[model samples]
Target: MSHLLRAEYGPRGRSAGASTWHVVRAADPATALCGRTMDTDAETRAEEEWGTGLRCCQQCGSLYMHEVPHMEGSHPYS
Candidate 1:
């Protein structure tokens, strides 16, 4: 049960509102345990657990998420 998450990246002095939204694939709740106290919400937990490795954009110093495309062969209709 992977989940979708939003990660942000922007200039140092900029507010979160000025940041860009990146849609990321997050681990399922059953797999995201870092031995720390859990957040009240799932989104925050996913961000904290998996957001560390996201790379910043070189051109704009912004971070973005990559969405995994659905493979046609995996779909029953295909």
Candidate 2:
């Protein structure tokens, strides 16, 4: 897990390691912000709001981003 959690850089840019799972659950943005559903859509609008910049789970309706960093380099801000 530690090895897999290395910084990954692609065309878009750098991203979390393997162990650092980025889960996107289907949900409603409005309802999620208020703590309701948890679904994610592949739409441009939703994607913009729930951009890859996210490093944490934002329970907006159902859409969300789960970023689990390594204990050694778990920088939530970066």
Candidate 3:
């Protein structure tokens, strides 16, 4: 089974203070991982085992978590 986690960030670069929602695959929903606290510099990170981890501004960063689901084909946003 898989679960999804939701994270909210301030913003990044030009689009600072933007809001974005990210859908990530997880092994268990009971696990409190990303919701604990906000790591300012945690824009990029490595996952442990069950799933992947990301750190970026949901609104203004070059990369975002909310864009994961809408992506289609070999490339995203063609």
The numbered model that scores best in TM-score is: 1
Candidate number with the higher TM-score (2 or 3): 3
What are the runs in model 1 whose C-alpha is more than 4 Å off? 12-18, 28-77
lDDT of 1: 0.34
Superposed Cα deviation of residue 2, candidate 3 (Å): 1.7
Which of candidates 2 and 3 is the stronger one according to lDDT?
A: 3
For candidate 1, write residues 1-78 as lDDT tens digits: 244333343455234432432333355332212222222242332433334554422322223222333453886777
Question: Could you tell which candidate, 1 or 3, scores higher by lDDT?
Answer: 3
Writing each residue's lDDT as its tens digit, candidate 2 over 10-71 gives 34533422212233323323223334332233121333333455443333323322332335
Give the alpha carbon lDDT tens digit for every residue of 1-78 in model 3: 233434445545324532333333344333223343433332322222213334433332222233343335656545
Q: Name the TM-score of candidate 3.
A: 0.23
Using Cα atoms with residue i matched to residue i, what is each candidate's TM-score against the true structure? 0.26, 0.18, 0.23
Best by lDDT: 3
Instruction: Show pairs that collide, candidate 1.
Output: none
Model 2 scores a TM of: 0.18
Task: Give per-model CA RMSD.
Answer: 9.9, 13.5, 11.9
Worst window of 10 by summed lDDT in candidate 3: 41-50
